[model samples]
Target chain A: MKKRDIILVAAVLILAGGIWLITRVFFNDSGGQLRITVDNEIYGTYDLKQDQEIQIGTTNTCEIKGGKVTMIQADCPDHICMHSAAIDKDGGTIVCMPNRVFLEIVGQEDGGVDTIAQ
Target chain B: MKNKIAFLGLFAALAIILGYVESLLPVFIGIPGIKLGLTNLVIVFILYLYSWKEALLISVVRILAIGFLFGNLYSILFSLAGGVLSLFVMYFMRKIPGFSVLGVSVAGGVTHNIGQLFVAAFVVTNFKLMYYLPVLLVSGVVTGLLIGMVSGEIWKHVGAYIRKNNREKL
Candidate 1:
């Protein structure tokens, strides 16, 4: 309602500043890939855009393709992992919560976990 | 007592209508289940025009009915926690001199989001969800402003109605 109130609103917006620095330091998601392998193969690689697909067959055999790893055809019912896009940055994860699987990419810059693959 | 019950029923219906209308305005952001909380206007007005008990009752009924009607049972935990926390915050804030219904409403809006975010972190099993906190807070500020404005307007109208009715009675 007042000129000062306008300044206060602007100050709040500018100062909010994401509070993201705390997250970066606390999580320690700095440089380097969190390499992942399943069933004796390079099943998933993080922190890059390789976009590979990995297929697991019969719960015993795992195949890698497309530069990333995927459950391909998992025995799980949700198939939520299949819906995830490819991740290539820090905080990115390929999580199969039902199948007891987790793959994370920790890029130093990106805070978003984009893809949870099959 | 009968009059109070009738007034509460009317507030319940008003809350339901506002909740339904607010649901139609979606955030373009991909996050799910976040809302602007337009129904808060009724609760804010109740705190000043009625009593804390009545305001709290309205909050609970509003959230429960909205949750059930939308089949958002999975999100009920967040809604319940947020609704209670927001009401508590506003109830305490109402004690301040000149705080007015608008100030109480703003405080409630902010606290609601705070409570919901706390639940979200636990559900996802990852604290990374905290990154969205700032966004949520900013949204809270905007929605708070809107709710505050609406509550202020409603209070003015209600005050005018009471004055007019009193004059007629005399």
Candidate 2:
């Protein structure tokens, strides 16, 4: 690798680290809600603080407890959504592309940085 | 010209096979966008051996073929977005001073994930998809570097062969 190649790799690594750090430090569950959407329409929103199981149209199910949400069940062939990490204080997402269902953690006010694009 | 066309077709087929191979493996890290991106090896090789246009053509054909055979329409859209953006980035990076194959491939890999997230966010109408940004970025860099290294080595060999052929033709 040349000088520029190292520089490029270093830059990307630093950027990734920075984003991870920022999300870990700033993303919290204070008034956060788990918003589930199906086919671009709102399915339901659940309080992150609540300990309950969400069955999303028989395609998938998720559980929220102690301010963390996990996809406990999914009918998708890959089961990737269920394998995804829980959305805790750091904020995360679970998507079942085959079923066209997705879940995300959004702050009541901030809604994360991607919302600014709107 | 015929030789180049034949090479391009071969590379495209190779890319599709790589995609199929990738699908056979389970998802890495259980994240949606994180994968070995093995086909990127073919893409990086083409970008170095041929040009951006040929790379773009091969990538599109490979993505479409892979999607139709192994994935759904949604995956095809995601591949299109990622493939095009990565190719575009690699094309420009190649022209910049001091940037080598590794740098170009790295840029391609990183931008590929960003482009995929952009489409996912749009399709779901939710920017919260950005949550995967950090993981995807790290994965991109790692996979890009691996693909870049392999392609760089291949180019060292195949590049000489192609140059000799060109000299003979001229």
Which candidate number has the best DockQ?
Answer: 2
Estimate TM-scores for all models.
0.66, 0.70
Question: Which CAPRI category fits model 1?
Answer: incorrect
lDDT of 2 by residue, B27-135 (tens): 7766556878889888888887778888899999999999899887878888899999999899999889898888888898899999988998898786656767988
Instruction: Give Cα distance to truth, residue B88, candidate 1, Å.
Output: 1.1
- Stretches off by above 4 angstroms in model 2 are A30-118, B168-170
- Where does candidate 2 clash, by residue pair? none
Looking at model 1 chain B, which ten-residue stretch has the lowest summed lDDT?
B161-170
Interface CA RMSD, all predictions: 6.3, 5.3
DockQ of 2: 0.34
> Which segments of candidate 1 are over 4 A away from where they belong?
A1-15, A24-32, A36-87, A90-118, B28-33, B163-170
Candidate 1 lDDT by residue in tens digits, B1-170: 56567778998999989988877766425554456687888888777667778888988898889889874654667888888898888888777555555556656876798788888667666665677676666676677777888878878998567546654441
- Highest TM-score scorer: 2
Model 1's TM-score against the true structure = 0.66
